[model samples]
Target: MKIAVVGAGLGGLSFGACAARDGHEVILIDKNDEPGGVMALAREGGFSFEQGPLILTDLREDEAVGGFLASLGIHLETVRDDRGLSTPDFDLIPPEEYEGPDWRKRRLEELFPAEKKGIREYYRFYDALMEIRFLSGEKKGLLNQLRLLRAFLTVKPYENMTCRRFTEKLFSDEKLRLVFNGILADFCADADEVQCFTLPFVNTETAFDKRIPTEKKGKLYYPSYRYIVGGCQKLPEALCAYILEHNGRFLSRTVAEKVLVEAGRAVGVRLEDGREIRADMVVGCGSARDFFTELVGEEYLDGNYRRILRDFRPMEAVFMLHLGVDFDPSAFQKQSLCYYYGSYDLHGAVEKLRSGVYHRGSDGYLIYFPDRHAPAFAPPGCHCVTIYTVCPDRLREGDWESRKELFADELIRLAEEHLPGLSEHIVAKKIVTAEDYRRLTHMKKSSFGGAVPIWKQRNPPYLTPVKDLIFVGAQSESGGGVPIVLLGAVEAYEKAIRANRAEGKGPAAGPV
Candidate 1:
């Protein structure tokens, strides 16, 4: 069957590659000159920077992304990170900082010396809750939910509450509350908004069950994360090469204007240039909103799908400040990723962000000193640093264009607060606003992917409403992250192929 994958991002490229290998003629199209959507990379002044998705998590052990890449003859080096929480004053720290079974206990002791016992019990309870879910997978039905309930009753019934409420119950000190609630910031959500069922998985999954090695000072995992040799662009480039090698064609700088629907099934896409390419299936590697509302047209969508697109808010857009600095690596602290939260009010921060406002001091900030992790990112004496914060795509009740510089200055100011003289070391800098992201990738509001990864919305079962027109990417069930997008592409193509074959269709009838 001939398949047309619109938007040659990781998801689209992955689908094209797999479909071509599965004996389908595939055409992967993107408006950009290259693939890789958000995984795109930029280089300047002897420094290379990833445009998006800096960290790679190895979720499932067996089909780990590293193994998948190896299967494709793409080798990647891994860097283990040892990261933890530090107080606003940078004095009080987590127990993971010290080491021992009592590390969490000790850390809690330092934060809430009065409520040390409660903290320890809380950790144990959270761990147990995570173990049950990991062991039981996502409960599917009333029976499975009953099983989960039974397990919770037997182990930790307190898991039923929200993390914010639970933390309040566990500790009285606001600082301790901040430390505990700060963990939710990693998910770009607040403790009250984030599901408690996800806390354990996130905690263990992100921390990788390893203490921050005193030598490394960040979280460590068995399979380390290595930047793609040249940059993240290499991944998409390699995947595109693989697809072409397998007889798949890619159409770059081409936009799919609309999904060509007939007889209640999508048969092809009409390009903005007025060219029509027919296909047995169309897989959209774009945002849910764009795919449903724009390409397919809201008139064709059902209420539930439209509501999901309408009511379902996207994750926050990020304000990224990429800097090329002239500095010695040894001159600065050796930290890969450093998160700073000005206040413990994470929920309030998220609420403000949802409404397209920046939270005061609560702006989610991440400082990436790539030279500390991968020297290849910069020259011998220079360093590359990126300061990122979650912000709404559009400002509330004002023109974001007019306020873009102010936003950028605010980020720089925050960076200055953290790294003194950081501005002086900057040789080059670029700011990526939500508008820039939207213009570049066609993502709605330049939103980051996978804001919500609940159990019900987890994988292939989360298909779009349109018949031949399928959806992938962070907005789809697979959720964001490189590995998930890759997996989503493969799964979507597989489904398309099976459906096409069942219909006895051949290469889709259309102009090449």
Candidate 2:
């Protein structure tokens, strides 16, 4: 079976490599000069930028990602033992910010000492939930769900209630509520809009049970987190190597013009170079909208089906700024680990963004100094940083292209405020704007990958209206981040096998 996968992002690489390993002919095509697509490595002078995916949370002991990497002879070490803290020694930074698994509970103890017992029980419940899900192989039977129904309803509460409403019930202080709010902000939705299940998503990220460690005044504090030994690019490069070693082929620097579909079935893909590559399955690691409306053509889809994919909203876009500095970046690592501008009005800031505004004063950003843990990122005595946050996908002041440099400059200024002299230390830099994201990652309007994690789009199914056409990547609405994207890739691979079985085709006789 010849499988043609479009886009060489993490999702595509995972599926293609898995299929090729199973003795299927896999041909991955991407417009980029190398593999890995968006997850691909970017370097300048002697500095390397992680590009996409700031953290690779391990999930569980049986995490498919670790297994997949092991199969490719890639061993990842636990990197960055770190915690979040208020940075830059500023007067505005809340003097008592916290990080790590213990921070949440410890924070409540400090601000609302009376709620200490309730806080302990709250985290205990969530810890058990993670255990149960892990035991169920991340899937629960009907009986299991029914048995857990009461527990689910406990945290879940009313379906539409946001994190603000839910957490306020537990803590009255707005700062404490905001402290907890940081845990779920990845959803890109307002605190009030974020759903309940996010607790497990945030806590169960580790492969092993993390025994909370004591935090000292100045050290990184988390017990579990995996950073690439050398750089994040190692992941995609390893996947590509595995696929190639299994005899899989790749068409690099080629744009996929369309997916060749006939009689309501996908046959192959037509490249922009006028070359058509035939395949038994077409798994697109790009936007779902692109496959139906652009690649396969909207005429191939029914009007109603087309409308649903069209109406599905893209996740909010984020601004990513990577800076390579001439000075030792680790000097600011303590501040960057999870530094946040304090006393923020998260809900109000998010609201302003929806109205096409930049609430610079109200909104806070994340700064991660990779070199502190992974020195391979920059040459000796130098460092690299990833500064990002959710920003409006569509801007108000000017087009993103025209305004990108200014936005980056402002971000640098902000970084300077947080890590005094961050501006002077800079030697090289790359700014990823909404427009750059749309072009590089093929995201819809440069939206971040993954659904908002509400009922509708959270963990959306793989099967599509078009038979044998499975969608992977952010637009499918499965939760975002590295682990979730890889999980979707697993679904895609399994579905491809089943699709072939249904057609009376078994696994390929040998590797392609």
Candidate 3:
């Protein structure tokens, strides 16, 4: 079987690797000259930075990712987070400050110490929501039914409520509410608009009881979190190399302009240059919107899928300021990620953000100093820092093109307040905005890719309306993030392989 995968992002590469190893001839295509998609590495002077996700966690508890890297003879160092906070800036709080109960509980207590019982009950409720255990029918009990009924009546799970609503109900402290809202920025969604169910699930996946320490602090590890020493891009590069070693081919700088469909089945793809490559199975590791509406043509799509794609709102975009400074954050002697609450009212902060207004008084900022863990990321006596914030995708009155410089300047000024004299220590600095992201990655709205991962929309979410064409990646059911994207690729390949075998073809080759 000949399989063609569009977009050589992590998802695309994973699909290619899986199919190639399964005994099929696979061809991976991408418009970028290299793989890794948004996960690409950026180097300027002696400083190296990860353009997209800075931290990688193996949430699935599977050894597939790490084992795959080891097969390629690559050894990755595991890093752990010594202290956790709701925000990115770690310099503000002391290590002992996080010592009481879990941060979530502490945050609740801080917010509603007067309503301590209510706050504790809220945590208990959140815990119950996260504790999902699949039991056989024989194990059913009346207690479980009562619990389910209570949840359905009080939780209002069907209302699509936001984190703000939950926080308001659970606590009244202004600072605590802001702390909760600060984390909401991480999801790139306004707290009031983001579904409440999204919060607990993300909390479980990222900040549960799982905490491991490495040789360095502020780095996190799971059973499978691994890094490709040269940088994260090396993983995808290695996967591409493996495919080639197994007689599979990778075509860089080739964009899949359209899906080639014959008799309602995906035959292959037509490249941007009008060259058509035929394949037994075609998998799209790109946006579902682009795949169906632009590439596949809306005529082939059913109304439901089209409506879903049209109505789905993408996650908010971010503006990142990557700086190479002459100091190591690890040596600074701070122990946790910091969350600075510049505003007293969390709802006001969210409203300001949604309205596309920058709060000039917002001293509250998120900052990450990677040199605290990965020293190899920077030169001697220097550190790499990424300052990020969720900004409006479009400037007020659509003047972003003319106002970008002003925005960058304001961000730098904001950083100067936290890292006194930070402007002088900068050896290299680069700013990436939503527009720049779109131009570079070609993702819609330049979004970080994919919708928020909530229970309602898990990985491999809706089945595409088309019979043979499948969608994967952040834009599909995988719900973004590196690990989920990789898993989505594997799932798509498994389905494609099964379909091929059902058509009387043999299994594709496995990884070499």
User: What TM-score would each prediction reach against the true structure?
Assistant: 0.84, 0.85, 0.81
Q: Candidate 1 overall Cα lDDT vs. reference?
A: 0.67
TM-score of 2: 0.85
Off by over 4 Å in 3: 59-75, 82-112, 133-162, 192-197, 204-230, 329-341, 344-364, 398-401, 453-463, 501-512
Clashes of each: 11, 4, 14
Encode model 1's per-residue lDDT on 239-327: one tens digit a residue. 88888887788898999999888877889999999999998778886677777778888887777777677655456677777888886
Q: Report the Cα lDDT for residue 131, model 3.
A: 34
Q: After superposition, how far is residue 259 of candidate 1 from its true place, in Å?
A: 1.2
Which portions of model 2 show Cα errors greater than 4 Å? 59-62, 78-80, 85-104, 114-121, 137-162, 203-223, 302-307, 458-460, 506-512
After superposing candidate 1 on the true structure, give the runs of residues whose Cα lies further than 4 Å from its correct spot. Answer: 59-63, 90-105, 129-156, 186-188, 205-230, 360-362, 453-462, 498-512
TM-score of 1: 0.84
| Span of ten consecutive residues with least summed lDDT in model 2 | 87-96
lDDT of 3 by residue, 1-512 (tens): 78788878888888777776767787888888777788776677887777776556552222555655565454555554432343332222423433532655664466456968756756665545543221112245987676565655555543456677776776676555554455565554556666665555554423422232221233222222333344566667777887788778888888888889888778898999999999877878655666777888888777777777776655556777788988654443253233344555555655665566655326355566655555687888788877767665665555555666666667668766656677777888877777877755666666675764333443333346665577777777424777777777777777766665676666445532
Better of 2 and 3 by TM-score: 2
